[model samples]
Target: MIVSDLWRYPVKSLRGEPLREAEVRPWGISGDRRWMVVDPSGEKLWAGEHHDMVTVSAARTGQGLRLRAGGRPDLHVDEPVDGPPVEVRLRGVGHAVSAGDPADAWLSEALGRRVRLVWLADPARRPMSEAHGGRPGDVLSFADAAPLLLATLPSLRQLDDWIAQNGGGAPLEMSRFRPNLVIDGDLPPFAEDTWNEVQAGEVRFRFAEHCDRCAVTTLDPATGRSGKEPIRTLARHRRWDGQVWFGIRVVPLNEGTITVGDPVRAEGTRSSR
Candidate 1:
C-alpha cells in the first residue's frame, strides 16, 4: 500500500491543510492541534456545537498562523511567547497560554461569540484517555484521543457504494472524516480493522482503536451546512457498542518524517480483543 494523502489540523476542529511531507512528533505531526478556540470557561468549542467552526481555516507558517473565513479579513497571529497562561481542559484542566486580544477579538467576531484562542505549548500537559486504549505514557495533542487517524481509500469506496445502494445523494469526500493519513492500494474494505501496527516510510505506529464517528463528520465542509450522511450509513452497518466507527486511531511508536507516496506495511497483526 502507499500513502495517498496527508493532512494536519493546526487548530482543533478548524479546516486543515494538506501536506506532502510532515514531521511526526510524539503527540502528532508538527504544528498540529497546538491551538484551539475555547469558550470563556476554557472549554474547547467543537465544530459539532458551532457549525461555523468548519468554515474557519487556520494555516501554520514559519512565524505563526493565518486565520481565514467568510466575511472577515484574514488575521495573522504570532506564537504566544509572553502571553498569560490560562487553564483549559481536554480531558482535564491544564495550562494553555493565550494568543492575546487580537486573536480573541477576531475569532469572536467570526464565530459571533466571546471566544479566545489559546495555545498549548507543551502537548505532554494532558495524558491520553486510558478508556480509549491509551497506556500510562501515551500522549495526545488537542486531538480527541490518538495522535493520528488513518483511512483507506478502498473502505471509503465501499462506503460510497453502500450510500448509493441505500438512496444516496452525492458521494461524500474523505475530508468529511478529517483523517490524518489516507492510504490506497488493492485491499479489501476495512482491511485496517485487524491491523495492530503499521510502518509508513520510516515511522511506525501502534493501533489505538477504531475512530468513532461524530456529528461533525456530518457537516458539508464546503458549505458549513449539516447533513445526514456517512454517519447515517455508518449507523446501519458499522455500529457497535452504541457508536459508529470508520477510521483507525494510531499512536506514533517512533518520531520520524512521513511523506506522501511512501509505502505502507501493516505489520504485527493482532486481534482487537
Candidate 2:
C-alpha cells in the first residue's frame, strides 16, 4: 500500500489543510489541532454541537494562523506568546492559553455564538485517556484521543458500495471522516482493522483503537449541512459495542517525515491476537 494523501487540522473542528509531506512527531503531524475554539466557559466547541465550526476554515501562516469564512473578512491571528492562560475544559484536566480578542470576536461572529480561541502550545499538558490505549507520556493536542487517524481507499470504496446498496444516496466524500492519512493500493476492505502497528515511509505507528463514527462525519463539509450518512450506513455493517466505527486511531512511534506516495507496510499484516 501507499500513502495517497495527508492532512492536518491546525484548528480542531475546522476545515483542514492538505499536505504533500508532513513532519511526523509523537504528537502527530506538526501543528495539527494545536489550536481550537472554546466557549466563554473555556469548553472546547465541537462541530457536532455547532456545525458552523466546520464552516470557518483555518490555515497556518508564518506569524500564526489565519481564519476565513464566507461573507466575513479574513482574520489573521498571531500565536499567543505568553498570553493569558485559560482553563480549557476537556474530558480530562487540561490547560491552554488564550489567542486573544480578535480571534474570539471573529469566531464568535462566524459560529453565531460567544466563543474564544485557545492554543495548546505544549500538547503534553493534556494526556490521552488510558482507556484509549494511552501509555505513559502519551499526549494529544485538541484531538479527541489519539494523535492520528488512518483510513484506506479500499475501505471507502466498500463503504460507498454499501451505502448505495442500502439506498444511502451518493458516494460520500472522504473529507467527511477527516482522516490524517489516507492509504490506497491493493488491500482488502477494512484491512486496517487488523493492523496492530504500521510503518509508513520512515514513521512507525502503534494502533490505539478503532475511531467510532460520530455526527461530525455526517456533516456536509462544503455546504455546512448535516445529514444521515456514512454513519447511518456504518451502523448497518460496522456497528459493534453500541457504536459505528470507521477509521483506526494511531499514535506515532518515532519522529520522521511522512509524505504522499510513501510505501506503507503493516507490521504482521494481520493482528497476532
Candidate lDDT scores, in order, read 0.89, 0.89
In order of appearance, the predictions have TM-scores of 0.97, 0.96
> Which 10 residues in a row give candidate 2 its minimum summed lDDT?
264-273
Runs in model 1 lying further than 4 Å from the true structure:
271-273
Judged by lDDT, which candidate is best? 1
RMSD in Å for all candidates: 1.3, 1.5
lDDT per residue (tens digit) for residues 125-239 in model 2: 6788889889998888889889999999999999999988887788888989999999999998998999989999899999998888899999999877999897888888999
Question: Looking at model 1, which ten-residue stretch has the lowest summed lDDT?
Answer: 264-273
Q: lDDT of model 1 at residue 273? A: 22
**How many clashing pairs per prediction, in order?**
0, 0
Q: Model 1, range 141-209, lDDT digits (tens) per residue?
A: 888888899999998999999999999988788998999989999888898988989999889999999
